[model samples]
Target: MKQSTLSEVKSAVTPRATLLVIGVVALQLLFVVSYVGALHEPKLRDVAFGVVAPQASVEQTMQRLDELPGSPLDPRALPDEETARRQIGNRDIDGALVVRPDGTTDTLLVASGGGRTLSLALDSLTGDVLEAQGRTARMVDVAPASPRDFNGLSSFYLVVGLCVGAYLCASILAISAGARPANPARAATRLGTMVLVALAGGLGGAVIVGPVLGALPGSVWALWGMGALLIFAVGAATLAFQGLFGVIGIGLAILLIVIAGNPSAGGAFPAPMLPPFWEAIGPALPPGAGTWAARSISYFHGNAMASSLLVLSAWAVAGVVITMLAAVLRQRRAADAGSSAAEAGATEPPA
Candidate 1:
């Protein structure tokens, strides 16, 4: 019995299997680090904020805000309260402080629709500063989040759902067929299937969030388009990963889009409020980019989303290129193998 058990263990723990297990363990550790590092403690950093005050005191206010320890806010002088509000609506600034020269009470304008946590942080920080100066400030939400949109998380969740659908659909398609497509035509067909799946998933998610759940309000068509692009980007990227690494590619896709991408996505915390590593990487990843674009569509009138769109487009294009390249390489290798086999057979002596 002992000898049989040792044989079974040796057979089960092949070198390849052992390496994959180690890889999985590493990925698990990375997931914990990414989530904890991103969410452990949130702080304000380089939040674009506006200050509206009389010409005489505007410079002083800007200077004071700039000199705050940690330099949490990037303070600029707006011409008036109206301009500050307009800038917030246009997604140019996160929050603004309006000074009342006639009295000790000031007004702080924030758009919670952008991010509730960030708006609250701005409120608290500005309030503390005002209190220290023997002044009081009133908090005003210029662009309030919908009641159902708790902490403005609906958009984040929607994007995450779309990403999950995309990768899963692509993974299923890859598994049903071979990991690498047999030829360029098969590769094209796989991509077409992904596009269709993305379209359906994207529109479904938009409808569920906007009309069905009332968690977000936006132009359904715009949301649909954004969703489709987001899904295609994720799906195509997953397909490409599968083409490159077979079954292991699925794990790689999960690692990139879920483990590393979700925490860095600014879903739970806005980019400026997250730790530096996550904040720096957020805008570049699909989940982060999709979340930003979704929020823009919902609240900011689709403003300031060009960069996010470009990032998604880059991912989609790269995925297509990589998938096609892998298919071509696979076809070439198969053809070479067949040619070698035929040549060897032709040279064999008659039996």
Candidate 2:
């Protein structure tokens, strides 16, 4: 009985099944590692900061900021406070330090609308430095966040919602039909369906966040366009993954887009404040790119979003190419197999 039971267990756990189990375990470990690694430490790095002071003091202050260890801030001297405020409003700089000529106190201008965590970090860092020099600093929010937008996270959540909608919808479509499309025509049809779904999902998300909820402020049209692009890009990528790897491709998409992409997205903590690994990979992933673009639309007047848009576009293009190519190859193989079978039948002996 013991020998029979051992044989049964061994038969149940085939090599292929074992490998798949191993793969799942690896993905699980990676999910934990990626999230923890990216979010464990939040430190400032290369934050663009403006300085407003007299000609002589401007250079001196900038020099002092440059000399800080790790070079956390990229400080530039603005001609006056008005320029500093204008630049902040335009999203040219993250924050500014204005030195009072007559007193030891200074003013730090921040925009919590961009990111509350980042603004707080700037305030803390500036305050510490000023305190060390026996000076005091007051924080002024140049561009405050909307009361509905807590921690400036509305944009991030909005993007994340769109991303979820995209991948989930694509995965369902693949599952309902064949994992790999039946043929080129089927693939085209699946892609076309995805496009329409993305368009509607994008517009709906934009409307909910902008008009219905008033959680985010921006051109609703621009947000709609961005949402559409983001949804299509993610959905197409998921489709491509399913075509290439079958059911396993769904896991691969989750690993890339959810496990790795979400934390690195700078949604909870801006890229500058995240650890190095997360910060480096953040802009390349769909979630990260989408979050950045959404924030730009909300707070930056859509400035500095070209790179993000390009990244999303690349993903969409690549997904379409891969899906179509995979379908074509699959169809060719099926046709060749059928032809070979017919030839074999023709040569067979008569019963």
lDDT winner? 1
Clash pairs (backbone) in predicted model 1: none
* Each prediction's TM-score versus the true structure: 0.96, 0.92
lDDT of each: 0.92, 0.89
For candidate 1, write residues 1-351 as lDDT tens digits: 999999999899987889889989989999999899899999899999999999998898899999999989999999999999999998999999999999999999999888899999998999889988999899999888899999999999999999999999999988886776778888888899988988898889989999999999988899999999999999999989999998789889999999989999998999999988899889999999999999999998898999999999999999999989999999999999999999999999999
Predicted candidate 2 versus true structure: per-residue lDDT over 1-351, tens digit per residue: 999999999999988789879889999999999888888878899898999988877898898888888888999988889999989887789999999989999999998988899999999888888888899889999878788999999988998899898999999988896777778898888889989998899899999999999999888998999899999999999999999998788889889899989999988888888887788998999999988888888877888789999999999999999999999999999999999999999999999
lDDT agreement of model 1 with the native: 0.92
Give candidate 1's root-mean-square deviation (CA, Å): 1.6
Model 1 misplacement above 4 A: 1-3, 348-351
Worst 10 residues of 1 by lDDT: 177-186
